[model samples]
Target: MAALLLIATAALLAFRGAYADKVYPAVAVGDVPVGGLPRDAAETRLAERAAALAAQPLRFAAGDRTWTPTLADLGVSLDLEASLGAAYRVGREATAPDRLWSAANLVRNDRAVPFGLRLDLGVLGRWCDGIDAEFGREPRAAALVVEGATVSIEPEVDGIAVDREAVRAAAVAAVAAPSDGVAPLPIVTTPAAIRAADLAGARARVGAALAAPVAVVHEGRRWELAPEDLGRFVAPIVDPARTGADAVTLDLDQPALAAFLSERFAAEIEREPVDALLGWNEGPVVVEEGVDGRAIQAETFAREVTTAFFAPGGTVPVPVEIVKPAVDGTNLDQLGITTLLARGDSNYDGGSFDRDTNVEVGARLLNGTLVPPGGEFSFNGAIGEITADKGYVVSTVVQGERAGRDIGGGICQVSTTVFRAALLAGLPITEWWPHSYRILTYEHDGWGPGYDASILQPEGDPFGGGDLRFANPSDSWLLVESWTTGVHVVVNIYGPDLGYDAQFSETTFDGPFPHEEADLETVNPALPPGTIEQTEWPLDGSEASFTRDVYGPDGELLESRQFFTKFRGRGNVWQVSPDMVGQSPAGG
Candidate 1:
């Protein structure tokens, strides 16, 4: 057993010696360990190789061109000093000794070397076509046939340094896995149609039918745009073909749309008023006459009113026409009459139409007819008479005291004044009457012609009351004016000039020829016999004639008109004392 043991030990020793010979030698002190040598020796060999490689040019072959780049040309090393700078530095300091084991691990760990990437869009140095190139191999054209992509690994010295390669492989597998590509979906707005839209029709149908509707909306303030009436607001809608997406965009002109909607869709409307004035019968005329010498103008009253149109926004007012009043002359017989007669019986009982009262009435008529075509004239309508009620003092009637007591007593004076005015106008007579018994107030003397008077009584015989009526008988109108100046009554007739030649000659017969007893008496008296108050005399008949000739524009006689009058005889009037005989007071 001992012998067998000795031989086996020897065999083991022999195998151990062989193994020790095969193992790498211990690195020198301060020298780094390399895979094949000590760190110091590995650095020396690497430096020699680098120096040789840098001196020569690097060769590169692409499709048809081969390029050699010297270290100087490639700008890799600008100088020998920069290339030789401590090429084997490991850690911080160049003088620090390299740890063999760590250096060996460090060299093995580093995988990437610095390289430049350049893209040549155009051929370098010469022009060429149909080619695009880069500093690295072409990505799309090169058939790599790679079992797997070559990848660099970053080793962790903190852990097992060699195991870091396996970790890098796993990370690369995660990034290289395939992923899906997605394109964004397009969105588009739809287009409007080219046909006319029913905008107005739709708006009208929205409200009540019987109501008055504002149909169209016109221009607006901000922008001058006409609103679409019924058929223009909406347009046809279309979809976008690319994305199968569709939408309608309202292309409303902002202001126009606002106006349209406000008018059409409105719930209520408004209204207003208007007024105007108008004229009648030509116009106001010039009235030269004034009341009591005060100048008065022609004036008339009128009326006016308003009209309106109500619109949606507000009221629009306008003007209308007016109506007026008119004054017309009717019952004109009084205007033309020239004479009147009133008589009292022997009783002195006031039986006749008082001459003064008749005269005043005639005055009123005269003034009215004198109003010119475009002039104004009035009587009470003109100058009003003052009598008992209107405050005129009473007086005995002129020409005849035999007439009974009357208020407007001596107003026959007014009648005479008007009669003269009428004559001056050359008016025509419609009626005329003479005073009874040839009163001296008119005839002045028994031989003088008597003044004509107008009687407005209904009707009477030739010997009774009669009326003289006359017309202006001219193209121009007349304005009659009369007023009492002190005791004289002045009358004026205003009219266009009438070219006339008028003349009158009167022939009177004798009067006071009747012989009668005294039949009338004083109120209180005791006079002796033969108290002759007056004498009654019958008058001789006589005739008087007037000739009126009108001339033309040349002053030649155009017409000769004649007027004739016959005087009748006066009857005998008696006077007597009241206490004497059968006659007490004649009127009583």
Candidate 2:
């Protein structure tokens, strides 16, 4: 026994010395045997094995779906030095007797050393996120639905999500044992935040709000909203104050409600304010009182209706806004119209019935017109369009150098009167056009030839018409009062009396030229053949001009302006038959 013990001791010392810088015999790293190999050689062998494993595809299975990805693609690699060191330390790290026993046992049965793996958790997590996005289902919260007068709740749904950590751990295990490269995916279920029980209160509130029809009253008018219509204005919203199942509330869509109210009641509740009409009796007098306008307060009324919708009664008073007129009866004194500044009169006696009717209609339209301070007064704008619909009659009118019959023929009588009033008032005449020829009606009542004003509305163009316009240079509103007596039409201007005296110089005449011979005759299809009827007598042409000097109340001249009038002469207008058309008179 003594001799056998000495031989065993020698063998043990040899074994320890042989493996001092190498792995023990029968030790392996992931099936790659590194036993009795030096540290560098063992590391090289392990690295070669790891490279082969990394190149191989790893299978990941979730249900029937599977993904085959290489270990290197998953950012996984073997720590070669750490694995080799572990393999080398196995038999040498224990007590002497145990170390000897382990070394002897390792020779008979190979021992596997767990691979020290380097895993990129970031990569693994991102890969798992992609899988989750592809196959995961998100939970749906409960909500309220309104259809007509009926209300109900939609149930919540539960969802499934992949367990990313479990997936990562499984991948690591599969990479370590390349022979079994398949990993099973783990899944978890998620519960929704709000369930059907949470929206019960909201559903009930919405149902009650739409249970009955509501009425909105303003003055004597009443508008009704049916239960079905009310449903469109109410909706369910998430309540931030609560959590879990009790976090939902029903609220009214105020804007939608306001729009609904406007559509139903706008025409009846809204109106424009009427300004007070002023007339001169002895001084400035309010002939008619002004009326305040009415408008619907849509938003305010909507809120009130929302509150009333849940109240005991279904009747709610509509909120209204009263709009005051700019010129009211009590504010006449503020208008600064203290006296009559000027009065212009024209004689329309012995005229035809159509001419008399047109002059009366024109004067009535001009009555009670107001010109704001420093604002231009447009005669065409004031009287609007001279149409037959506005009570104008067909009468004689001047077109270019010829007198013809058309609608609104005698309307110039009114424009001429307004021009005389504005001129006498010392107002600035911005636009003025004289008649194409002299008219005895304008030269009536001692007014000379240069005092006429003409206005015409061009066909097919509203703004292209001729207009007599003037500017009020005062600090007060000017009112025009026009009326007609039995034979004479009168127009008067009322405003703050700016003390001004207007002086007119003697009128000068230039020529009495005759009309072109071509214009002497015109073809008339309505007249009989070989017949000639003189429609108008010939009138000689003349140029008339006069200067006016406006003086202030203190005798200081304020303005000096010259007014010029060119009257084109016309030969006799004769309506001849087609056979006699273009024929000159016998004398010529």
Candidate 3:
């Protein structure tokens, strides 16, 4: 008995030693057995099973069409190392008896080791793409067509879809079992949201309405919308009051109706104010009379048409408001247009070709302009943008004692003449600006020192103001006449003779400042040392002022305005000899 017990003990020890660090007997990976397998051997067996599973194919059917895809192409994979590790641990325990008992149970039944699984849905989706086109259809809903006063209902169709996820799930289960059979792609169906029965009442409401025509008439002009066009305007709808018993009826689309009226009548009824056309054939003549403006009253006309549209005749007369011209041909004589009311004249040295061009161009712009009663005139605006393209030229413009050349330099001559004309006409001088330096040309023609006016585009002027402007205080239109003869240019304002008088007091020059000299030396190598050359003459500086007074038609002083100005002496300019290098300027 002792010998037999030792042999049994040896056999058990051999068995444990042989199977060390390996899966015990009766252990299974899926349906395949891996009993007593080492880590490498178990992994090899699992890999073989994976290969065989990858070789299997699945039959996928959507209606009459069928597609087969291998399990490997569907992203099926197995972790052989993990499966082997689970099998190896089946009989592993801390105590010998517990390990022995676990080994006995493994030998008794084939234990399946649970494992994780993975699939690439992207690959599956690509295979299933477009499969639905053969087995799916979209549902169509009911619709209605509207004639002038009629509506009709259209039918609905059901929808069907080939289920995509269900097919993939079934494929997964088949691939996992390593077997192949026919699998169906589940199909789903649904009814459309709106059916033909829903529009029964709405259709009857539109079909039962009567056809009618409407007429739009204006000033002997008439346009009619017939029944055919009226048909396009009708539509059926759900019961608005929610009574659920009333049939939907045809109604006029008010927006569409209003659009039609605007299209046919808006342009025909709008007119702009026209001024009387004056002509001169030896004397002023009204060649073409001005017409009064007119505007269509859209709201009133629309209301009338809409009200009459439902009535018998359907005739509507257009409504418009008359707008009268401010100064019509009938009042040309009262505006003093037949006679001269005022005149302003000045002279310019036409010796400079470019300077004369600017002067003449600026004067022509002011000619023939008509200023209505209570209207203001802008000298700068009349000349527009002062560019070289406007026929002006680069010439001398003086700021204090500084002088520079500009394209529209001579425009100031025209502005100064206009300013004097405004003063003599007894009109309200709303705005005026004086030059930075007194221009001798302005004083040459019996005008005072403070009479010169200068101008530039708003951006170029430092004072941010216009050079000259005036308001026509007369109750009629005023016409400006301008012309140039030799070096003299004149501006005359013609309007109803207000019989008012204007006068300017003598210019007072009281304050005087002695002239100062400044040396503007230019190097002259040809001259001897200490030698000086005077290039410019200097003048004394002074302040001068004048007053303008205007009387009313009754000879009463209506308003008084004063003009004040100052002149700075142009400091003397001198050129020094280059030979005077070592000499003191004071010594000279």
Top-scoring candidate (lDDT): 2
Error of 2 at 310 (Å): 9.5
Q: RMSD to native for every prediction?
A: 43.8, 11.2, 18.5
- The window of 10 residues in a row where model 3 has the poorest summed lDDT is 242-251
Q: Is candidate 1 or candidate 3 better by TM-score?
A: 3
Give the lDDT ranking, best first.
2, 3, 1
TM-score of each: 0.31, 0.53, 0.43
Model 1 lDDT at residue 259 = 49
- Encode model 1's per-residue lDDT on 406-439: one tens digit a residue: 4545454554445555554455544545443344
Query: What is the per-residue lDDT of model 3 for residues 1-588, given as tens digits with 9 covering 90 to 100?
Result: 999989967877777788887777778877768887777888888888877777678776765777777766666556677767777887787788887787667657777786435677886666555555655778765556655544567776778775656766765676447456677656677676556776676555444433455676778888776655655655344453542224343345666665666666668777877666554444455656778898776666655655654453658777788878765667766665655656787778633677777889888766766787788887776667777776777875532234345776677888888887888887887777777555677776677788776666755663355557788886677777676788887987777768778888989976458766453445556668777765444666778888889898889998898888877766555556877643434333
The alpha-carbon lDDT assigned to residue 458 of candidate 2 equals 87
For TM-score, the strongest prediction is 2
